[model samples]
Target: MRLRRRVSPLKLAVLGGVLFMLVLVVLQRDVSGGIQEPWFEDLSNRKERMLELVRGAVNNLAFQIPGQPGTPQLPAGGEVDKNCPSGFYTQAELKPWLERPPEEPHSQGAGGSAFQKDNLTPDEKKEKEEGMTRHCFNQFASDRISLHRSLGEDTRPPECVERKFRRCPPLPTTSVIIVFHNEAWSTLLRTVYSVLHTAPAILLREIILVDDASTAGGCGVYQERR
Candidate 1:
């Protein structure tokens, strides 16, 4: 039996060139500053070595196989998807940022009309004023009555009057989970900042984020910011 010859130099060179181009396509999608510089340099050097190795292997394989051809070279200037890894987002994936929820308007005094104040009739204005006054008084009365009730009536006051009310212990902490399909970087960051600023540090435990299969590159920006 005759032993088959290895791949030829021509085939090996072609395979090597193809691998180099693949590396370039991969690098073009990188946007982060820190990763781009070092990644490009490393990829360039590694690609050179990879091309040589692939070329040699292809040549050897070509010789061994009677009719096997080397790997085909990809066309130049072709586009490649450089979106974030499997769990990450791509630019196109997060093209449109999520619309913000409408803001809650500032509350007016109870006596103020919901609509324009000028639209109210004299009778309506009088009713609103009376209603506001009653509401204020009720609140004030409740607080005062509670304070008085807490201090029981005693003919002779003890050195330390017995306090009747028992204060409740603190409640358990809670976690808020926000699920987004394809949220924008700005909106996501704003949400995080709002939570951090407003939520009581002791009461808030952790914020769990669940992604619902959003295909976007903005996820990378979110991660880097975090």
Candidate 2:
């Protein structure tokens, strides 16, 4: 009887431990009562914000430009062009750049004006025609002034412009490849100049100009001068 009494306490202790473990497991599962995740709400909000940004980017990409000849000439920055199919910035976003000056030209030097055939000598007419072919590589444009203007005139916010540049000796070289298929004279040169003006000179390995076959060809303007 004494032996049975001592074993009974041991059995009770084991049973109690088993019950405590079972209760603990049941409470672990039911503690949250199958509630939704706390972070799920935040995840949903972030997803909505990302979607909005993507939509804005797509709209901006669909920027316009006048294309058809006799397209009611909207002076540079005059109105949103309907012809340009896509762009990095939207019309509304570009409005600040387009608004005209106070009826007084800031600085007028014959810049990127399309060479007019009306009052040109035969040689001049030929040069102008060839220039047009290179302008868009046979692409169409109803307006040219806004884009052909100098890069200095760009109105973009200077987010990427470095306030301080890091210079290192023995800088690694880089090769820049610019492919042209009847590209415009001013813009092409600008594209090249843009690189030269921005990048560290020591790092520029080689500028490789590969020209795709373009039918546009003409007498070299400098060759005539020479």
Candidate 3:
């Protein structure tokens, strides 16, 4: 007789969330009223709208009890502390650091307008096109931006900012895992920096990066440093 293993609820939630998002992406054109374009702009604008749906679905699944219709519940902050007292949120000096105004125009690809190819020189345009052909994205713009660049104030919602949680029972510490293959150096490093910058030090146990047989030169540099 062979034994069958039962999947954990957390694993089931993660798998279901992944499959849900994949299906949404696959049927994006049909669900989004047949809006289709080859460029990144079209997809970028609709991503937020798609994410809201995914969030709602995931949240609904997360609190589901066994053999019951999932009733979505908001996070219970009464028993656990959600906020970090020593986090960047309370640091007065660091508040301006991420959202600081740029000294020069078109510096570090600061705004949405910076991505427009209409303003690029012939040589610049050629380089960008070549980069896109090789990497399937705008490597040229990515190279110009700083790895720790500020995302500005409009990124978070007011409701999230205004919400408060209890500090009695501490929240669980988290270990972040990032996986990549042939990712650009600037973007990859930026993601690490972003996690370090935003996450509270006390709650962030460690970061584990998994490389999936990448042939890029960036991977060699990363491995050598390890």
Candidate 4:
């Protein structure tokens, strides 16, 4: 006798979220001025509706998959303790990590370099594009690794680290969603983390990444560590 595989609700929810993200990625291309929420255009819109949307997505991705004991729950508001690593509920609660010192400034790098022939190996195929130049290739590349190499660490400015600049609390948390197709792994990941690091942790709720079915094969050095 053949047995049917059983799937849990949590799995189904995650699948729904992934599918939803994928759809949004496709829909975004069709919209001008980028994808925007219709309700957010007017203050008269119910804010809770947005939260409900977040709650739906959160429920899908949170908690352990199938066979797990933990269940998702909302956090009660209280005195701000620290940043919100959860990337959803606690963003409004984050204050400057004032106790920590400011980060050093990042130094700018050289002008640019095109994808050289020697750099293009058999493993990568992106260079095969007709008449592709270095400038065009670098334009699409990420500076995440370059930044780390040139700037040591903690490259944030004094204002970013100082708590004196903070506005009153009770701010709203947000979910970050990114959709891309055939994006360089390094650049795409850097974009993801740049958002995470630049924003106060408390202000972030969750980060959603959806692939738009990329076909960029590889770009030699770009793919080296992505």
TM-score to native of every candidate shown: 0.25, 0.32, 0.48, 0.34
Please list the C-alpha lDDT of all candidates, in the order they appear.
0.47, 0.47, 0.61, 0.49
How does residue 104 of candidate 1 score in lDDT? Answer: 27
RMSD to truth, every model: 29.7, 26.4, 19.1, 20.4
1-226 per-residue lDDT for model 1 (tens digits) = 9999999999999999898677576674452334658757677667668879999987655532323575232335764334311222233332322322333233221122132235767876676565447443322222112111111234456633331211112224678788876555444554665565445565578888888898765546323210
Q: What is the lDDT of candidate 4?
A: 0.49
Task: Give candidate 3 misplaced runs (Cα > 4 Å).
Answer: 1-106, 111-113, 116-126, 217-226
Global lDDT for candidate 2? 0.47
lDDT of 1 at 62: 52
Cα lDDT tens digits for candidate 2, 1-226: 3554356888999999899667655554554466366554455456558769987766443322224232233347655545532223323332321232232133222233342324667876566566566463422222223322333354556853322221211124689999987656445554665566555554576778888886667524321010
What residue runs in model 2 are displaced by over 4 Å at the alpha carbon?
1-130, 133-150, 153-156, 162-173, 183-190, 214-226
For model 4, residues 47-166, the per-residue Cα lDDT tens digits are 346758988777554352332334333356744435533323333445422223333343233123222334655534454443235334553334323422222345579864442222
- The model with the greater TM-score, 2 or 4, is 4
Model 2: worst 10 consecutive residues (lDDT sum): 162-171
